[model samples]
Target chain A: MTTSIRLPKELKVRVSEAAGHAGISSHHFILQAIEEKTLKEELNTNFYEEAEKRYTQIIETGECVSWEEMRCYLESLQSVPNPIKPIARKLEFNVKN
Target chain B: MTTSIRLPKELKVRVSEAAGHAGISSHHFILQAIEEKTLKEELNTNFYEEAEKRYTQIIETGECVSWEEMRCYLESLQSVPNPIKPIARKLEFNVKN
Candidate 1:
């Protein structure tokens, strides 16, 4: 199938020059650009969605360890040849009601 | 400095259960989740921005090769021991004015 698009005289000049430098047809360059744009957008969208899913799970299960403890454990492991996984636990908040 | 947030009773129960399972404080779990969410979003944002930048350059320069030609060149390279970059060229459109 054939389609047509109108480019201003200035853009035409740029396209022609770019096509010449790339050693490819202006038609091919435009197509490649569109393809790449779509692919990247899709990938990024999917990545964010996956992150959200994980976040929901964490909220639902509340499974987590504090950064301070994790950091300390990691530091302690620096001296050991083989380090073991640090234990995780719930945060105790002193809620005043 | 310390900050406080209110979670519903149900959520609190979930967090405690999750914290117990993870062997870390509920506080840590929430922090880690937030950190991961933020990092992924930033990375994805940067990725899209980079893609847009490249696409803009492609448009400005009009430097591109057609998918058909690129695909053929890639296929041909499969049989070769050492492959060279295929030449690119501008597209010629039959414009009616």
Candidate 2:
């Protein structure tokens, strides 16, 4: 497909120079740049969405394992092939309600 | 410093249970979870900001190296101790204006 884009004179000079140095057409360079940018945006969106989902789940369940507990278990795995897994549980409070 | 947060009864139960399983206090677990989330968000922000800056530079300069050119150069580096760097340049058009 063909399309048109407007580049200021300065940009046109820059693109022409860059394309010459790279030994490829300006069209390919622009296409590659667009692809790189689009992919990164998609990846960023997915990362945030996944994090949000996990955040909500943690909030609703309140099921969490402390960093201290998990770290020790993880460290042990450095030496041991199959170390025991860390378990997550609830905390106690004084009040019934 | 100490702070207070309200968790629904069900979440309170879950937090207690999870903490028990992990052998840590509910407070520590919650704190760690919050820390983890905050760090990831900071990282995500930095990643996007860096990408945006690069994108703008490319647009203004129109100086880009094609993916095909770069990929081949990159692949060459896998076997050779060092490879020549790919150059970026501008493209030619029929019309002067």
Candidate 3:
């Protein structure tokens, strides 16, 4: 698709300076820059999506490693060459019923 | 000034996905992304320009600290509380007469 974007006066000057530095035309520089930002934003979106999925799963399943178990695993890193892996257990919430 | 850019089929789709994630219209997202990239590129150009200027000055002035002095200062970092600072001396090129 083809579309027009309005560039401010100062932004136009900056683009020209940047484009000259990179030995490319202002239009080419803008295109490349937009492509880069699009890819970066896509990666960020994917990261947050994955994180949200994991968080929802944790909430529903209540399957997570306890802080004590995690601490033990971390502390064993130096003393114990082969530390036992921490296992995820169902979380228990104390509800006042 | 307004200019039209033709986006490839795949890139257009990617842009839409990214724009959706950002909760913004594709045009707005493109504009924002382009501005971010332009600013980043301008900074990079400025950095290189500064480095180039410094390098040109170093060559023209021939004022630079010797590597040996630099190494001595680095080595003294642990032992000496106030290590003598390395002074810049006019670099002498051992050119054959």
Which one is best on lDDT?
Answer: 3
Question: DockQ scores for all the models shown?
Answer: 0.01, 0.01, 0.44
In the order shown, the chain A TM-scores of the predictions are: 0.59, 0.66, 0.64
Q: What are the per-residue Cα lDDT tens digits for candidate 2 across A1-97? A: 2323444465455544555555666555444433343345446666887999977877888776777789999899899999888776664435876
Query: Per-residue lDDT for B34-79 in model 3, tens only?
Result: 6887778778877888999978878898888888899999999989
Model 3: per-residue Cα lDDT over A1-97, one tens digit each:
6767777778778778878887998888878877987899878988998999978988898898878889989999989999999987797866798
DockQ metric, candidate 3 = 0.44
Ranked candidates, highest lDDT first: 3, 2, 1
Task: Report i-RMS for every model.
Answer: 22.8, 22.8, 1.6
Error of 3 at A51 (Å): 1.0
Taking candidate 2, what TM-score does its chain B reach relative to the real chain B? 0.67
Label model 3 with its docking quality class.
Answer: acceptable
Q: State the lDDT of candidate 2 residue by residue for B3-91, as single tens digits.
A: 23444465456555555555777555554443343345446666887999978877888876778789999999999888988887664
Give each model's clash number. 23, 26, 0
After the best TM-score superposition of candidate 3, give how far the Cα of residue B89 lies from its true spot, in angstroms: 6.5
Whose DockQ is higher: candidate 2's or candidate 3's? 3
Better of 1 and 2 by TM-score: 2
lDDT of 1 by residue, A1-97 (tens): 2323444465455544555555766555444443343345446666887999967866877765677777877897879767766654456756899
Comparing candidate 2 with candidate 3, which one achieves the higher lDDT? 3
